[model samples]
Target: MKEQIRCAVLGLGRLGYWHAENLATRVKGATLVYVADPFEKQAEKVARELNIGKSTKNPNEVFEDPTIDAVIIATPTSTHAEMIQLAAKHKKHIFVEKPLTHDLQEAVQVIQTIKENNIFCQVGFMRRFDSAYMEAHNRIQAGDIGTPLYFKGVSRDPGSPPAEFIKNSGGIFLDMSIHDYDISRYLLGSEVTSISAHGNILFHSFMEPYHDVDQAIAYLTFDSGAAADIEASRNAFYGYDIRGEVIGSEGSIQIGSLRHHDIQILTKSGSTHDIVPAFPERFKNAYLNEIEHYIDCLRNNEKPSVDEMDGKIALEIALSAKKSFETGRKVLLSNPTLSLD
Candidate 1:
């Protein structure tokens, strides 16, 4: 029998922890070999619980360890490009979370490095791995949604991140709306040609200085003549919600909501509680399915369904939207550039 691939996880935050725990306990043909975090206690705790081979505060330990075959980066968005470059230099396959990099130049460099190294690199656009979304994609490709015309994607969170996080989040367009950007591109099957956006800082007063718009809407014109509308909100008040619809020449398909029952009517003192909470719940299966696909891709030596180009294009759309929101004018995506802080 072949030996297990050695894997390590960087960053021990919420999403990082989840990736570490899941890869350690659930994935087959992979051994959880190391856990790295700047916080020593968090790394040690997770490593102890999972019986991982090593835990360290310095990420260099994991990067330098030749025995470690792959690394999962759940670090902050600002650190993605550097980590990717480092891991590529070490010839380690990498799994990085979304919005590949805060800057397009860095993104381009990382892609070039990964290609030069001839190492597998997968960005976390987990939604593409979703069964429902994949089903929709297959149908669209199979001509079920003949010649797509328009796509709409909505993503709303229950609340905003802490003020400190908001400052560094690259505003809502890069942090949250990027998901919708990716989905829109996936459904449209074409490159975005131009983008226009409008946004407001309605919910959080603290976000004003950072220009962190909490509510945003963007329009994307695709190269194939299809268009898409993406809506995003950091505060939903009630629940997390994400849904999409693809309208084509022949017909349309909509992804169902989270609720088991589509229709519910209640009459009690003229009050009703009908809508289900947002996407974290609605796309639970998608999260698991995405990770499983990553594992399978690694095991089979297959390229990821969502590659660096997909991540770059999504980031391009998101940055364009931000530019449009700021300038109150349409932004062309032909020559995409971003300012990294």
Candidate 2:
């Protein structure tokens, strides 16, 4: 029998909690060894529920444990680099959530350390594991769309995040549109050569102190003569509608439909309507499927669907978009092989 992979998850917040729970209940050949969070109460609660082997406020305990083979970092954006460095020092495989780090320089450092350690590192670009998105990607690559020319992606939520979260969100483009950046690259199969963007705090004026923009639209031109338009908003009244369309020379492919066949029509003086809730319902399977893929990769000793380079490239595009937004001009992405400094 194969040995079980011992895993520790850092952070017990919303997303982290989900990671712990899913690993505990769904992942085969994986054991939940430890959980860490600054909030002791939250950590204790999850520890008891999942029957985790250990719980603590300091993540170092998990890092120091020789038995723990891997660490899943779901911590805040700022702490990712430090945690990744520590994990590498311990010779533990790492799976970190997106954006890598808040600053580009720090992101570069993190990648370098991982390379030096020669440990596997995966980034949480979960959407790539989703079935719907995978279908779209395969179709585009198969030339079903015949030399993709343009792509459009929309990611909108029903409401803005809390004021505190907005303060640390690194604006709408970095925090939210980063996903679209990855998806754009996936569908277009080209590096983003240049980007231009327009953003404003139109919906969430109260978040002005944080310089948070609630709405942003970015245009990306790829090296293959393909282009992509990404629109992101935090105040879509209908629901959390995320959809994409790939337009090529032959035809177009649209993924995700708001209307399901289960919708019932009621005839009351010729009136009918459909029910639409928030994002928690729309993308639930995508979230679960992502965790499953991570666990499978760990068990098989195979690389994850998304790796550190994908995360860095996504962050680079996002940072470029922010620069374009601020300067009112297009910003070009430097070659990945070239040193930015």
| Candidate with maximal lDDT | 2
The alpha-carbon RMSD values of the candidates against the true structure, listed in the order shown, are: 3.0, 1.9
Cα lDDT tens digits, model 2, 200-250, are 877788888887788899999998899999999998877677888989999
Off by over 4 Å in 2: 259-264, 269-276, 337-341
RMSD of 1: 3.0
- Over the stretch 1-341, how does candidate 1's per-residue lDDT look in tens digits? 33477889998886788788778888777788999999999999999998887999999999999998889898999899999999999998888988899988898899899999988888888788777688888999999978999999888888888988888778999999898788877878788889999999887888999988889999889888999998999878877777889999999989656453466666766644455565555666666666666667777777778877778878888888888999999998773323221
After TM-score superposition, what is the CA distance of residue 320 in candidate 2 from its true location, in Å? 0.5
Consecutive 10-residue window with the lowest summed lDDT within model 1: 332-341
Q: Give the TM-score of candidate 2.
A: 0.94
